[model samples]
Target: KKNMVKTGKAALLLWCQKRTEGYKGVQVTNFTKSWKDGLAFAALYHSFYPDEIPFNSLSSKSSAEILEMCFACGLRHGIPRLLDVEDIVEMPSPEPFSMMTYLSQCYHTMEGGQKGRSGLASIQVNESQQRQQPA
Candidate 1:
C-alpha cells in the first residue's frame, strides 16, 4: 500500500515537472527546483496520507489534477483513510486500499455474467448467522 502511494506520488511529481515548469518559461535551475519541490511535496503527502491509494478512476484522470486533489484533501482535517477505520483512532494509518478488492469485484462480475446462478442471492442467505444454543 505504501509503495503504491509512493509510486503514484513519484509519477505525479514527474508529470508536474514536465507540465508547469516547461510552460512557465522559467530558468532551468528554477524549473529543476520546482520539479524537485514537487517531488518533495509528493513524498511528504504520501508519508502522511499513504493509504488513499490513487483511486483507479482518479488515476484515469490527469496526474497533475490528481496531485492537486490530494494536496487539497491533505489539508483541512482530511479523510483519515490509512487506518481503514473512520471512527476510532484520530490519527490516520498509512495503509493503501486493497487492489484485490477491485480485482475480485471484476472477477466475480465477469464470472457471474457467464454463469447465471439460478438464485437471487450471491451468497448463502439462509445459513446460520449465530452459534446454536444447546439444551
Candidate 2:
C-alpha cells in the first residue's frame, strides 16, 4: 500500500508537468522526492476528482506525518512548481501605441502637465481659497 501510494504520487507529479495546461514555459530541471510532493500530488488529485477520495482518508500514515515529510526537504531542497524554461516560439514586438502607453498618456493629461500641475492644481487652489474664507 505504501509503495503504491508513493508510485501514484510520482506519476501524478510527472503527469502534471507533462500536460499542456500545466505551468507554461516551465522545465523539469530537478525532480525532488519528498513527502511534500506526495501531499501536493494528493491535493492535486483531490482537486481534480473531489468525489474520488476524501482528504482525511488519503493514507494509512497520518495526514500530519505526510505533510511534515513534504516540508521536510526544507527551503534549500524541494519540488519547484515551475522551472526556468524558454519558449520555443518567438513573440512579436509590442505596438508603439499599446493600451498601457495610451492609458498613461491619458492619465498624465488628466492628472497634470509635465511642466506643472494641471487638473489637481485647480482643485488645490479652490481648496485653499475656501480655507481662507471663515467657516
Candidate 3:
C-alpha cells in the first residue's frame, strides 16, 4: 500500500515535470521545496493557457502574489481550490499530499482537449444553470 502511494506520487510528479518542461525559471524536482516559490504552478498553468498567463511577467511577482494569481486563474476555470495560498506561503515546505491532490486535479482538468498556443477551445459555463452537455 505504501509503495502504491509512492508510485502514484512519483507518476504525478513526473507528469508535472513533463508538462512544465521548457518553461523558463521553472524546475519541478519535488512537490514541496520546488513549489515554494509558486513558479511550478505558474508554469503548469501557463502550459495549458499560455496566452492567458504571460510567462515572463511572473518573474517580477512575489511568491505570495504568484500563488494568488495561479489559484485565482484555476478558480476561474472551474478548478477547485484544494490548497490555500497563505498555507503554502507560510510553510517552508508544503505538505506533499495536498500539493499532489491539487496537481492531479489540475492535470485531469486540463487534459481534456487539444492544446494550441491560444489554449483549449471555448467552454460555456453558466453559473445559474446546471445542465449537462453530451460530448
User: Each candidate's lDDT (Cα)?
Assistant: 0.33, 0.35, 0.77
Q: Is candidate 2 or candidate 3 better by TM-score?
A: 3
Q: What lDDT tens digits, residue by residue, belong to model 2 across residues 31-112?
A: 3322222444334333434454344465676544434432232212323212111110121322322312322232333234
- For every candidate, C-alpha RMSD to the true structure in Å: 19.5, 24.2, 11.6
Residue 32 displacement in candidate 3 (angstroms) = 0.5
For model 2, what is the C-alpha lDDT against the true structure? 0.35
| Model 2, backbone clash pairs (residues 3+ apart or across chains), number | 2
> TM-score winner among the candidates?
3
lDDT of model 3 at position 32: 90
TM-score of each: 0.24, 0.21, 0.78
Ranking by lDDT: 3, 2, 1
Instruction: Give the runs in model 3 whose Cα sits over 4 Å from its true position.
Output: 113-135
